[model samples]
Target: MKILLVDDEESLLRTVQLGWPEPDDEIVTARSFEEAKRSLLPGRAGDFDCIILDLQLPDASGTTILSEVRKRTDTPVIMLSAWGDTQFRADTLMSGADDYIMKPVGIRELHARTLKAALLHRKRSSPKPSVIAIGNCEFHVQAQLLKGETHTTKLTGAEASLLEELALANGEPVLRTDLYLKVFQREAQFGDKSLETYVSRLRRLLNEHTEDGAAAIRTIRGVGYRLVA
Candidate 1:
């Protein structure tokens, strides 16, 4: 576990560097908002497992950094503030903070929360169906990236939902009606174009890596469709 520390207090930073849970890559320290951005960059999909960020920073507000981090990665974040304001706590959680800690916080509490955050992150980052392989393409359901051997495409929210339904079918034909009901959370009616449109989009996305082109999704005519290998 690599942890990024974004605090301006030199005394606390030094103590945390020497005393925190032993991260695999050592404690990464950032004293300002710009420095924190520098440490998190090049792969915003989390260079670290968890981040300990101070709500107060010299250059920019921690909320700005938090919003930016969420836009790019699923990394768990724990916001640190000197004040234990109720409104501040509510706002931070709404703005994508995973956990919150007030100053004069115990080291034990910090360790425990970090561990909790890590476990939660791991669970949420992976789908139950997990990695689904269809022929030569691999669909990372939770990550929302459909990967080919030499190419890749990102899945939209609707596309991922449809793919998850098809994956759960285990290559058996999943009815169009089932898809409509499961994905849209409503009863299917005739002439609903939503299901078919997403199916068409997924078919094209999967066909991007194949010799028997357009072969990953099988259309069973009057039945429905199945994910094929």
Candidate 2:
């Protein structure tokens, strides 16, 4: 795996580079947001399997760098911060970060989380049915588009990822926790309604594009959700 490490702390960067668990993995380091942007140039952002970004940078806030990364690619980003505030963690998670870790982290734990995030990203992005039919609507997974008999709708990355999981499950019920981990790359937390929000969005889209009751997303109560085609 190719990983990008962005932090102004020279010592932490050096430690991560040397202590990376996988001997075959390549590590790229950038000390500031500008340097990170240079490394993520137009043709190069997709080269990274995962990014370990510092919450505090010398020139720009980590959120700024995160926005830049999201604009370029959906590469898994794990934010590292010394700040332990709950709001900071929530804000980053809501802003598309795959994972957030408190600073003074152990190399082994970091490596594990990093690998999990990358793996989940790969799984979400893996090839599936390019187009799925739901009633009169056709969901183009690769294109992130939904075409109905009358109108079309585009899906956000998170929405598309959620749909992919349900499509892959066919008619079977997928666990909520499993979806949270696979889709969000983190465990579900109390009061975190992101999954519900995506599901609601999909429900609305399905309702808009399909005949009444032609297709539906069923909540499995204690389990999770399933798609009824």
Candidate 3:
């Protein structure tokens, strides 16, 4: 898998380079934000599996880079920083980081987490059909864009898949287990509240285009959900 490593520290960069799995692994290291942007310019977002980012950089903050990355693609991100405070963790997660790690990290653990996060991101980001319609709402899969009535906006990869699965089932109440399996293609993992979170986020995304109606996605207690469009 292709990876982008961003850190200002040359020593840590060398360590990461030596720690990676295969000699053929496509890994790019950038010591500054400017270089990172240059690396991105030559390819599309899906060209990289994951990005290992340091929170502190010479030109920009990690959050700034992360926000910009989110704007471009849904590539999984693992924040590598010396700051391990609760607030920092919360802030990064809210800003769209997949995972957080403190600096002076073990290469093995970083490799493992990197693989796991990249796999998850890849699962969710695979392109499907375009413009799935449920009730009145429309989901544009290729563009990761959504539209209903007069409004239109983009959705994250996971959010689009979760909504698409429920929407395909029409208004039927899908079981939580089934929904998880169908959407994520695996049993629940620790803190994989991402499914439920995507449901809520997708609901909000739907609401932007909906008018004068209760939200299209209804959470059935003890069950998964139903799309009312």
Question: How high is the lDDT of residue 180 in model 1?
Answer: 66
What's the count of clashing pairs in each model shown?
Answer: 0, 0, 0
Q: Write the per-residue lDDT of candidate 1 for residues 134-178, one digit (tens) a residue.
A: 877788888999888898888888898888877766677877755
List, residue by residue over 51-149, the lDDT tens digit for candidate 3.
999999999999999988888878889999987676667567767888889977998899988987786566556664567774466777668778778
lDDT at 72 for candidate 1?
79
TM value for model 1? 0.55
Q: What local lDDT score does residue 204 receive in model 2, on the 0 to 100 scale?
A: 85
Clashing pairs in 2: none
The candidate that achieves the highest lDDT relative to the unseen native structure:
2
Off by over 4 Å in 2: 130-229
Residue 123 in candidate 3 has what lDDT? 51
Off by over 4 Å in 1: 21-25, 129-229
Candidate 2 contains a number of clashing pairs equal to 0
TM-score for all predictions? 0.55, 0.63, 0.56
